[model samples]
Target: MFDWRWDFVAEIMPRLLWATGNTLMAAGIGYVIALVLGLFLALGQRGSNRVLTTILREGIEFIRSTPLILQIFFVFYVGPQFGLVLSPWVAGMIAIGLHYSCYLSEVYRGGIESVPRGQWEAATALNMTRWQTYKQVIIPQSLPFALAGMGNYLVGIFKDTPMLSVIGVYELVHTANAIGSENYRFLEPYTLVGFIFLAISLPTAALVRLFEGRVRSKMGMN
Candidate 1:
């Protein structure tokens, strides 16, 4: 009792493609937030203030342990009760970004630790302040190490964008579901979505690997 219809695929292609754009946009926004905030989180864990470091570490661990959907619901549903009302888009982005920031902080910490101890000693010998040492030397060297992990998460966030549908985001899956409900046919739309994801994810993953190689080479990390 299964049938595939090319006509239905064509009829729905435009709307599906439009929703795909929204999906990409959501991923991009969330990724940028994670990139910036994750660095700060990684650094906070290394600070001299023991209490602050412990609290920050615990908070990051808590976020990492919980489900992202729970975080999304908490931000969207619970925040309104606390006078932190936000739109679905805002709530989704904040939740996704914050969730990934914790994961990325671990990645960043690993990258930072990969740098040679001598590098820090050399910076200290030059009388560089902590900020200057991190900004000028450590960050540049650590970035290549982090690049692979960063690329992985970039693809990860893209894949996870579908979770936004639970919060009413009009992303690809959400649109596909709507189209299927309207036509009473899920076969075509859902199949198209799978192929679309395959088409996008394959190339994106390849590009990330390619970009990582280039960054490594440019940093003389090859």
Candidate 2:
């Protein structure tokens, strides 16, 4: 339906490449934060304190219910009003990271729940503290179970990085849009963005599967 232009692609390649770096940074950094925070969130829901458990469970549900874009806006815009101002990059990272962490929390909870009740009973019989039981027994087993879900979300977060553009974080989609607006060639910019995402996503997803196998094998889960 529209014309394609190699010259325009050539003109925008460098900018797209630079913006790809920003996209990776957002995905990588945000994923790391989500990994750590999600663990705590999952653990908090399992705590013996009923009040704390209820609060955490409800909070995670609320986060999972809302759209991530609103969170990004809240963190970037409303945050300043509450003395929590941050740069676009930082705000987008935190917002998306926190959004995904709630999802990962559910994944972790499922993995944790999959562990045998006998394991918990044995830990109780041995008089291990809950923290010690989780650290020494539950976590090691659960991690392998959780790996596949984690891998899925790893790809998901990378794909979702485009949402950061709404907050003006110069990720791939934002850069492509800028380029299109400048050159009046949406085809080249958008097509390039799709290819770039596909290129990165396919390899990353494969690697995640490979790593999952390695982890499961290493943990004697396979």
Candidate 3:
């Protein structure tokens, strides 16, 4: 006999909603960290020094090649051995941020590279400083190309936030698991989690696409 209880769903809805806030926080924080750090990584790869570029490139590759869960475990468990004890939230954000940063770095690199060589030449001819070239010319041009990838990873980081539950971050999935265990009913909680994710994700993806179109049109890349 399969049983679905509306009363149980109603009772747990508030708790799940609260946990949804935590999930969104985790995803938002992780994405911000990834966005900033990934930009730095991409810039590092583009720097003049071969040694720094090699090191950054290899480090990005290594992180990208490894499993994200292991990175989370390492930061959570092994960090203490190195005198770097971090709480679950800190560790989860750091691990997720760094993991996604590697991927985002590649996205940034592609975007940066997509900028025509003539633009760099024009910046040089105009006696623009390196920072000025990037700020005024390159980054603006690159944004449209990068927006799609950035949007994809925004959703990706949101989905991956559930992995933080392994270290006890109390995100939506973790809260759902806890609720299911306590109530001895897995069906409703898990179903609600999926629907919640779907609701958020579909709108987010559409908005990203819309934003990307606007950026492209504004930049005359369309």
Candidate 4:
């Protein structure tokens, strides 16, 4: 009852590969957004404005507590009611980016807190601006601590991109589902998707670990 067809695999390969590119684009754009926004969120929490910090903390908590699929659906579906409709790609990216940004903010907070208080004192002693303190000293030191979490979310966003399919973004899982529906061969298409994900994720995780070590060594934290 097990029949594997190489021809079917070959036929669908091109479409899947094309979709893979879209998936990577989605993940890359979302990750960039999350990375920058998460940093701002983390800094906001530590900033002088108590009200803003409280709001940002609550926002992050709310996002972290919800399911990402619900977020994606809300952005894509509910926005039209408020006159802020976005395309599938834009909506998916924003939803994924915002969802992951909350998690990454926590990672950044931990990293920032790990910096010794003496470092802040030293920055003050050296007449460094707040910007200079974070840019030159705190951030560089926190990077190694943050890198592992950042990398995990990089992969997490990639995995979660499939949820975008519900909104009609033509990413890998969507393509595979299309192929399966057309041919009624879920086996090959789904298995191939798994292989493709594994192919990407394994190498990325290894590189993250490698980069973490290099960063720590350079920062003399090794």
The candidate that achieves the highest TM-score relative to the unseen native structure: 3
lDDT of each: 0.93, 0.93, 0.95, 0.93
lDDT of 3: 0.95
Give lDDT tens digits, candidate 4, residues 1-222.
Answer: 379888988999999999999999999999999999999999999999999999999999999999999999999989899998899999999999999999999999999999999999999999999999999999988888898999899989999999999999999999999999998999999999999999999999899889888888888885
**lDDT pick, better of 3 and 4:** 3
Stretches off by above 4 angstroms in model 1 are none
TM-score of each: 0.96, 0.94, 0.98, 0.97
lDDT of 4: 0.93
lDDT of 1 by residue, 1-222 (tens): 377888888899999999999999999999999999999999999889999999989999999999998999889999889888899999999999999999899999999999999999999999999999999999889999998899899989999899899989999999999998999999988888999999998899999999999988887875
Error of 4 at 40 (Å): 0.6
Candidate 2 vs 4: which has more TM-score: 4
lDDT of 3 by residue, 1-222 (tens): 268889999999999999999999999999999999999999999999999999999999999999899999999999899888899999999999999999999999999999999999999999999999999999988989999999999999999999999999999999999999998999999999999999999999999999999888888875
What's the C-alpha lDDT at position 72 in model 1? 91
Model 4: weakest 10-residue lDDT segment is 1-10
- Highest lDDT against the true fold, candidate: 3
How would you order the candidates by TM-score, starting with the best? 3, 4, 1, 2
The local distance difference test score of model 2 is 0.93
lDDT over C-alpha atoms for residue 185 of model 4: 91
